[model samples]
Target: MVLLLGIAAGLAYGLTAFAGAFLAVPLLVLFADVDYHRALPIALFALGICAAIAAGDAVRARQCDVQLSAWLMAGSLPTMLILGALAQRLSEPVLGTIFLIASLVFGPLLLLTLRAYANRMAPPPAALLDAPRRSFTDATTVVHRSTADKVGVLFAGVGCGALAALAAAPGALLGWRILERRLAGQPHLSVGTLALASAVLATLAAGWQFLFVADVPGYTAGLYVLGTTAGMGIARRAHKWLPQAPTHRALGCLVVIAALALWVVVVRGATAST
Candidate 1:
């Protein structure tokens, strides 16, 4: 099960560049009987590794936006460190409640993000020469980015950090929505940039958790990491050949299912305790 959890988490990250932690934590809590706080660090560590793998592929493909990723990290890092420390003080039930709420909120939003990404058309070639508009090359495409987009991305990072630290889920669904709007034409670049940002933030937070909050089992972590590596390897090979529209819907359906499972866990835990 530990290995399977890792594979599932990694597969999700590799395919969508999001939700690795979200899927891991709930599955851990519900199936492995892991406490919310204890599961957080383990899930986050997996998320960090998963994101790193995806980001590396993206960077190698020249699909990443380094500038945007930097800004996102700048905004997310401080908040993650601070809130992560505070989270240790929260009761298991409270933390579980927070995670449940976050899952419910972001699950549907993930669908929306996917829909927006699918529906938006690529930028016209003339966009490359539009005067007074600043254009930059992301791999092979010329996309225009604005100052407002930068600020918005920063805020999105801050939001992701807060959610990651408090709820054990990176707010990548929110970040994706922002990227969908801001980087309309370039889906790979948007995914890559956000994956890079999420990788750094998750790893930093996991490191902090390891040092100050939790003692993760070496065996468990190893199993999860190994599983994630295998799952991502498969995704890397198959993602291009996969149909985009139905794939997005299927992934969205999985998110909704995970959210529903989380709801069950929270309610059962609360009932049992009472």
Candidate 2:
């Protein structure tokens, strides 16, 4: 069951950077009967591997900007560690509830964004949400020069880290969205850079949580990694022909379903205990 779950999760990760972790956490809680806290670290560990594979694919395809990814990680890693540790101190039920709320928020938002993009509508005008005003064409891609400001990149990283620490799954959606705007018309670059940055953050955060914050089930985590590895290989091969919009629609629906399922579990557990 865990292995199967990993494959599904990995496929999601490979196709769309946000869905792998988003799918894993709640599915683990629902099927494996794992606690929310433990599920978080386990999903994140496997997600790191998937992210690495995705990043490598992007690099090979010349879709990634390595330097930009580095700057994003510089601010994100430490923030994720600090906030994740703090989040660990919260009660199990509280943590689960937080993840549930985040899922509810991000799932529909993602779908909405997809709809807007599909129609060729403009995004919001906020500084963070707007497309970078200045861009220059390069041999490989169009570089959004204004988006590379060190301060802005760091701030975006910090925000992404906070979101990740709070709910590892939803954070990826927002992170992807932010990058999508900055790297407009460069879908692969946005996904690749975020994947690279997230891979480092997720791995370190998983390690820290395993050592100090939670007792990660080694057997379960190992199975997930194995499954994820296989699934990612398949995704890499089929990436060219994959229908991204349909895939994201499925993801949005599944995420909402998972969140509702998790809520039921939380409520049942609370009632039983009370």
Candidate 3:
């Protein structure tokens, strides 16, 4: 079952992986009895693999965005180090509660952010960035925006680090929602980059936690990796024929949100009981 789930998860990350780790963590911890202690690392490990695959795809698509990736890494790595160092001080319940609250709170904030982003004035179309925004194959299309808007690029990197540490959600999870707003009029990061970023961040985060925080049997983390991979596989099969029309996409998002909401409630209740 673990192996099966891990494969399913791998596919999910491979495809619309924006939220694979977020999608996988609760399920693995809640359903598979993979305690939070081990669950996060396992999810991260699988996410790492997912990131590598996405990176490959980005390279193929001529959108690798090497500069962006480097900047993102700069922001994410330090936080990862800080969070990993302190993960032990934070218990599973604390992390879970934080995850739950963050999800609950983020929805409204996201709405407001989206609205603000939408209302921004557009820059003249013909005016271009100093460099034509040239980047690798699998990168987001270059866009022109207010100088103030461009600076937030740093926020992407720093926030990714903090969020990945806090709740293991950096992909289409919170990051996607936020980016969707900021990049509304432009091509988003190549899906490949999004997926690979998830995998890489998750893997690194998981590795750090496993080495320093959790002391479970070695095999347990292996199960976590297996479980996430299987989950990705399942998600991949589900998305095989998924249409990306606006209607279909909206419906899909609602379904995932609903299911995740229910799962979260169930987990909270179970945790309270146990």
The TM-score that candidate 2 achieves is 0.84
The alpha-carbon deviation from the true structure for residue 224 of candidate 3, after best TM-score superposition, in angstroms, is 3.8
Q: Is candidate 2 or 3 superior in lDDT?
A: 2
- Give the per-residue lDDT of model 3 (tens digit) for 1-274: 6665566555544444233345556656655667665666666666776566545544554533444455456667788768756655676657666666655555334344434544432211001111134354324555455545334545576677776776666534444443334545433343433444555676778778777644664565576576655544444345535432322234234325633553565567568979
Tell me the RMSD of model 2 versus the true structure. Answer: 5.8
Q: What ranges in model 1 sit over 4 Å off?
A: 121-147
Candidate 1, residue 239: Cα displacement in angstroms equals: 1.8
The best candidate by lDDT is 1
lDDT of 2 at 114: 79
TM-score of 1: 0.84
Query: Which tens-of-lDDT digit does each residue in 99-171 have in candidate 2?
Result: 7887788788878877877753222111011223223344256355665465666777887777667666526
- Residues 1-274 of candidate 1 have per-residue lDDT tens digits of 9888778776766665444456777777777667777777878887887778767766666667777788788788889999898887787667767776777677676666556655662211111111122234535564467889889988988999998898666787777667767766776666777777877888889888777655567787788778877777766666666664565556656766776787677778778988
TM-score of each: 0.84, 0.84, 0.68
Error of 1 at 76 (Å): 0.8
